[model samples]
Target: MDQGLAGLIGAVVGITGALGAAYLAGRGQREQWRVQLRRDTYGQFLARTKRAERAGKAVRLAMDSGRFEPGLYATFAAAVAEAEESLALVLLEGPWSVASSAEDVVRHLDGWRWVVELWYDGDGTLTLERALESAGRDEDRFTQELEQFTNEVRRLLHGRDHTLTARLAYRLAARHSA
Candidate 1:
């Protein structure tokens, strides 16, 4: 082979290798950015959900006291609305499983709001005790859904290996309970 042709081939290979490396690096960076964005959105949704839960508790407290505090209900409603807005982002940034869990969480928040409304309306049907009980159940369901969402987020950011480990642990616990 000619020396000039050999030099040209070597240059071509070196340039191609550099370009490939750069492309891979850029792709990795983009993926990292996407993960960060999802993480931030998930955190925001959780924060809003917590705020709404706190507001819901306040409404329940007023009900327990036998007071019709519209302001408390309004605050709770506003918090729920904000959480829902955060949920919109979660849905947009979702892997479907995470979005579904978030939706469930929001649904429970809405259910709690409904219970509060029914109590406030006072149609002589819903007693304060029942309303409180319903709220407690809703809170429990919300907590379960939140944990599922967190697990899903972890799986998404980490990998399927984490999910497998979690499933194995859950099965072991269930077996022990049985």
Candidate 2:
């Protein structure tokens, strides 16, 4: 073969290899960005839901104590609204399973809110004990749904290594709490 032809062929191969590598690297980076985006969205949703749960607890406690604190109820309603807003993002970033679980959590929160509203407006028709019991059931279901959502997120983010991811997440949570 001619020397010039040989050099041209070598250059073409090198250029092709470089281009392929660059393309692969770009693809990897884009995937990483997407995963990060999803993680952020999921975290926001979880945080908002937790806030709503805490607010609900506060409202329930006040109600149980025979205190009709309208401010607490307002706070709880605001928190639930924030959580619902976050749910839209979760749904947008979801793989269906995670979104579905998130939806369940929101639904339970909404149910709890309705229970609170009914109890407040019951005017003695709805007993406090009955309302508390209903709220407890709603909370339990919400917690289970939240756990399912977390598991789905872990499976999606960490694939088959969810146990390891769970441990890491726990550690991070513990660290942050401290």
Candidate 3:
């Protein structure tokens, strides 16, 4: 992903995890939930992160070349699948307490689906400038949404007293440059 989006997302991780983040809170202790959520959230992060990188790479390829050809939808499909699976896990595992702004995640999924539909119509004929504009707009919107959701999650997670998992996330996040 571009530095703008990457920085945006890194900040978001701290912000969202603390926003009463959606968590599987059945009979487990809060720490347990936090630990599990840390892992799950990281997995979700990796999937979306890769998707962002792939989309950015595809755009660059198209821009560098003369034609609009790079598997946009195919890459987006992986992101869609990750989001769907996360939702499913949230639904199936326990009563998911939604953090504020995560509803936007669902909205992003819808927007991505629209992007896929646009791609299905044949991007070869689409103007490269127009296509890039569309992609940049979509990426901006979704990244904003993801940033907000992540801020919420960070808020929820970091608001509590430090636990092993929380400290681990903190250390890991600290290891990176802003």
lDDT of each candidate versus the true structure: 0.84, 0.87, 0.55
Identify the runs in model 2 with alpha carbons over 4 angstroms from their true place.
Answer: 122-124, 161-178
Query: Comparing candidate 2 with candidate 3, which one achieves the higher lDDT?
Result: 2
lDDT of 2: 0.87
Q: Estimate each model's TM-score.
A: 0.85, 0.89, 0.52
Best by lDDT: 2
Model 3, 31-74: lDDT tens digits are 77666776586457536544543554464455546554446555
Task: Put the candidates in TM-score order, highest first.
Answer: 2, 1, 3
TM-score of candidate 3 to 2 decimals: 0.52
lDDT of 3: 0.55
Question: What is candidate 1's lDDT per residue for 138-174, written digit by digit as tens?
Answer: 8778766766776787788887546556556645643
For residue 177, model 3's alpha carbon misses the true position, in angstroms, by 13
Models sorted by lDDT, best on top = 2, 1, 3
**Superposition error at 35 for model 1 (Å):** 0.5
Residue 142 lDDT (model 3)? 60
